[model samples]
Target: MKTQKLTLTVVMVAILVVMAYIPAIPLGPVPLTIQNIGVMLAGAILGWRNGLLAIIIWLLMAALGLPVLTGGSGGIAPFFGATAGYIWAYPVAALFIGLSLQALTRFNRVNFVTILLTIIVFGVILIDLSGAVGLHITTNMPLPKALIFQLTFIPGDIVKSIVATILTLTLRQRFTALSHA
Candidate 1:
């Protein structure tokens, strides 16, 4: 069981890293990437503990100067850069998603509605808000402006969350070990 957990966690981390490397649109301090989908999946599938661990491990890899983040930009620079707020929020968001799913599962309500709501709340809104906050703090952007900027990410985030939800549900059916406990 431990080995399975470790293996699945590593796979999730790898998936997130690969997703990061997909083509990104540079948007000043915050570039748009699809990695958030994988992050949400990690939380919903791996649960809070392993999901958070996966994000932390991936962040550590980037901090260690590996080309594992968006646009091949790695190292500790991003952590302290304008993306810092979002970076800091990744594990927290993952943890929230995982915890939400675990609780939902306990109620036998791990269906589309619950999964979608959690992803929209914890995964989409939480991450985008954190990124906006980071951008505001790091770049001296006004708080309102930063928040408005986050609005532009909503459509994309919604789409990504939907994708993550489908993937989570599918994977959960096939791999009981990966489903939220």
Candidate 2:
């Protein structure tokens, strides 16, 4: 179990790293990337503890100057920049998704639609809130304006949540180990 967990954690970190290399669509100071999809998958598939660990590992690497963030950007500087909120929120979002799924599973209510909605809600609430807060603080923009600015990310985030849900459910069906306890 330990070995499997370690391997899975490494795989999740790799997924984040790979996703980071994908070109981002820049909109103002924030850029949209598919890295969140990897974060969602880590949580939904690996559960909270392991998923959080994977994200932490990836973040640490990025902080060490590895190109493990969107558009191949990394370093601790990004963590203190406008997009810092989104980066900081990754683990929290993953943990929320994992915990929610685990609870749902306990009651045998883990349906595709349910998981999809849960991911969307959690992603929007957690990631957006954190990202907006970070933007507002770093740029000294008003909170409302920062939130409005985040609206541009909604469509992409929704699509990523949907994809993450489908992929997670499909993978869960094939891998019993993915089912959270």
Candidate 3:
């Protein structure tokens, strides 16, 4: 049973890694991608540790030259490039997002959904803020412009959070083990 769970976790994370590569509408510097949804799903469905592990696996793959990032951005260059900080913050984001949901003691259906939504949005905002700082440092731009660039993702992030929350809640109800961490 543990092996089966591990296998399922691996498969789910792998799918998310692939989803990370799928490019979305590139609106300027901040390209809207499904990667955020993947991140949220990892936390929401897998809980904290396993969700973080999934992100770790994906990041390691990207670090190893897999083009798993948005817009085909990959290799070591990206790790040290403008988006580096945001990329680095991803695992942290996932971890916190997971914790925010699971830490809730109430643990009811509605509470779970509420916690998930709160955490997902919080994580997204953290990523956007971190990415904005990364852009400022990398491009040597003013803070105001960097903030504006970050705001471009607001719509997409909201959509991603909603979709991920819904999918995760449905999966949790359907698959009991998935909710067990």
Q: State each model's CA lDDT, in order.
A: 0.89, 0.89, 0.74
lDDT (10s digit) by residue, model 3, range 1-181: 3675577569767877678667678666556677877777777777778878888888888888887777655678777777766787778887887777776634553454585566556558888888888878877878799889887888878878888777877776777665575
Clashes of each: 0, 0, 0
List of clashing residue pairs for candidate 2: none
TM agreement with the true structure for every prediction? 0.94, 0.94, 0.86
lDDT of 3: 0.74
After TM-score superposition, the amount by which residue 151's alpha carbon in candidate 1 deviates from its true location, in angstroms, is: 0.9
What digit string (tens of lDDT, one per residue) describes model 1 on residues 1-181?
A: 4888899999999998888779988766687888888889889989999999999999999999988888877998898888898888889999999999999999899998899999999998998889888888888999899999998789999999998999999888988754455
Q: What is candidate 2's local distance difference test score?
A: 0.89
Error of 3 at 61 (Å): 0.7
